[model samples]
Target: GAGVSQTPSNKVTEKGKYVELRCDPISGHTALYWYRQSLGQGPEFLIYFQGTGAADDSGLPNDRFFAVRPEGSVSTLKIQRTERGDSAVYLCASSPEAGGPLFEQYFGPGTRLTVT
Candidate 1:
């Protein structure tokens, strides 16, 4: 895709189920990131991959959350044993590179996860 694309714009799942959200980033973008945005709050970085390796995964809330970009162009965020508090908009963003200066991100519309 020419721009970032996220699947399942809205997802409703059981409180303990597992789910995976997908992201297809813009062509040639080497930096991919995943963030979570709660209502009325800004996106919080969850993980970032530079090329094929995770540059950072500091913001993943717990072991239940994980992400990967094995090929560097497409990524997925997976959640296990979800809880009601896990409901939020999962955003995917991409930039030209991984670090300093030229890293302005372009965002996807996000997948709204609702657990009941």
Candidate 2:
């Protein structure tokens, strides 16, 4: 892909349901990240992956949130037992490399998940 792409730009799910959002980062990029943004808040880091391994998952709110980057390319974010408080935008970004002093992340438009 030429740029980051996130699926189901808008999602409406009942509370306690599970949802999966997809992200496709720029081709050849090695670093992938997932973030969450509540209304009027800056994006909050969720997870970061360098290749197939998650370098950081400290920012995930709870065990209900999980993400994976299998090929160091496309990634998926899975949320289980979604709650009304979980309604927000899920964002994805990618950089050419990870663990560098200067790394610029390119972001996807984001998936707006609404828990009704």
Candidate 3:
């Protein structure tokens, strides 16, 4: 079976533009997560979804960022009014079940977004 995948491996946009990053998780994985990784920094948690609803979105930096998993499989991360500070590699991960200390997550290659 295919693993988690992210589209548009790289993206470049002007500041104040809007961009969407997509992710497809493994079939039947009930938990999905989004993260942002900046230069030399660890991935920062953005949001977590269980099934078709968001379980935790506290990691989202601000209102400009949002994500949805309408059917409990594929998800999209939407960024509005992009800024230079938003440039980073956006990563997606999925686990067999909900995230916990014992569950392992599979990760995608990530979509690199650059706002110039």
For all candidates, the clash counts are: 0, 0, 0
By TM-score, the candidates rank as: 3, 2, 1
Lowest lDDT sum, 10 consecutive residues, model 1, at 94-103
Model 2 over residues 8-97: C-alpha lDDT tens digits? Answer: 899999999999999998988899999999999999999999999999999999999999888878899999999999999999999988
Model 1 off-target regions past 4 Å? none
lDDT values of the candidates?
0.93, 0.93, 0.96
List the candidate 2 regions with Cα displacement exceeding 4 Å.
none
Q: Model 1: per-residue lDDT, tens digit, 1-116? A: 47899998999999999999999998999999999999999999899899989989999999999898888799999999999999999999999876676679999999999999
Reference-based lDDT, residue 37, model 2: 98
lDDT measured at residue 89 in model 3 versus the true structure, 0 to 100: 100
In candidate 3 the C-alpha lDDT for residue 49 amounts to 95
Error of 3 at 69 (Å): 0.5
Q: Please give, for residues 75-114, the per-residue lDDT of candidate 3 as tens digits.
A: 9999999999999999999998864768899999999999
lDDT of 3 at 15: 99
Give candidate 1's error at residue 44 in angstroms: 0.8
